[model samples]
Target: MDILYLMILCSASLAAVFLIIFIVNAKKGQFEDDESPAVRILFDSGEIKEKENNGNKKDEKEIGENNKIEEKSE
Candidate 1:
C-alpha cells in the first residue's frame, strides 16, 4: 500500500540522516579520546577538599588550621 511505502521511506531517510551525522562526527575525531575521561578519573588524587560537601571540608580545614594554631602555640 501507499501508506506502507511512505512509512518505509520516512524510516530510511531518518536512518540515512543519523548515519551521516555519525560519519561526520567520526571524521572530526570527536571520539578519538573516549578513554581519556576514564583515565583522568582514575588518576585523580581526591585531594581537592571541596567546600560544598556539607561541612566535611570545613571540618578538615578547621583541623588543619587548628594544627597550625597548635604549632604556633608551641
Candidate 2:
C-alpha cells in the first residue's frame, strides 16, 4: 500500500538524522575523557579525607574548651 511506503521513508529519514548527529559528536572529542571521570572519584576521596581530619581537630578543640568551662563553673 502507499501508506507502507510512506512509513518506510519516514523511518529511514529519522535514522539518517540520528546517524549524522552521532558522527558530529564523535568528531568533537566528546568520548575522549571517558577514563578520567571513572578515575576522578578515586583521587577525590583523598581531599575528602583531609577535610574530615581538619573538622575533627576543630571538634576536639571545642570539646576541650567546654570541659574547661564546666570545671571552672563547678
Candidate 3:
C-alpha cells in the first residue's frame, strides 16, 4: 500500500538523522573518557569517609549543646 511506502521513508529518514548525530558526537571526543567513570567509584570512598566524619562532628556538637541546655535547666 502507499501508506507502507510512506512509513518506510519516514523511518529511514529518522534513522539517518540519528546516525548523523551519533557520528558528529563521536568526532567531538564525547566518548573519550570511558575509563574515568568506571574508576571514579574507587576514589569516591575518601569523600564518603570525610562526609561521615563531618556528620559525626555535627552530631557531637548537637549532643554537647543539649547537655549544656540540660545543665542550665537543672
Best by TM-score: 3
What is the full ranking by TM-score, best candidate first? 3, 1, 2
lDDT of 1 by residue, 1-74 (tens): 99999999999999999999999999999889878788887553425533334445456677778557756955
Candidate 3 residue-wise lDDT, 1-74, digit = tens: 99999999999999999999999999999998999998887553546645666677466777677657756966
Model 2 poorest ten-residue lDDT run: 41-50
Which regions of candidate 2 deviate over 4 angstroms? 45-74
**TM-score to true structure, per model:** 0.58, 0.56, 0.63
The lDDT of model 1 is 0.74
Q: What is the C-alpha local distance difference test score of each model?
A: 0.74, 0.78, 0.79
Span of 10 residues, lowest total lDDT, candidate 1 = 44-53
Error of 2 at 19 (Å): 0.8
What is the TM-score of candidate 2?
0.56
Clash list (residue pairs), candidate 3: none
Q: Which digits, one per residue and each the tens of the lDDT, describe model 2 over residues 1-74?
A: 99999999999999999999999999998877888898876553546645766677567777678657756966
